[model samples]
Target: MADKSSSNAYWAANVRIILISLVIWFTCSFGFGILLRPMLSGISVGGTDLGFWFAQQGSILVFLVLIFFYAWKMGKIDAEHGVDE
Candidate 1:
């Protein structure tokens, strides 16, 4: 019973984390990178709009940040839930 409850909690926690991470990912990628391209048109980088950088390089950098953040957060989450392994 305890194990099952813990498992359920772990799933719920992970799901919440993933959903939050994806929302941030999408916002940073499609929102600033594409959807709001016109708004960011004034900013340029090496003969390219900032949005272009966001779509290509910026998103990848954000992804790496998210990855490390997720790893750190998940580690804390795992320890909190007693599921670290």
Candidate 2:
């Protein structure tokens, strides 16, 4: 019925958001910090190579930002689905 479809849509949206966030976190922490380090070496941040900065600090900062983003996004999603408190 319509309610079941709405529930499915809500869950689908939620999962999509989770997947996107995880991809960003993984790309920042692992892809930039390790896989792309050599390519980013030419760039400098705070007296260190960009890659090192990502490994040491950038990823953590990105995670915190993502946390806030996820919360804000989910709030909107919840409201749309009539699930917000």
Q: What is the C-alpha lDDT of each candidate?
A: 0.89, 0.92
lDDT of 1 by residue, 32-52 (tens): 899998899999899989999
Per-residue lDDT of model 2, residues 39-73, tens digit only = 99999888889999999989999999999999999
**How many backbone collisions does model 2 have?**
0
Model 2: CA > 4 A from native: none
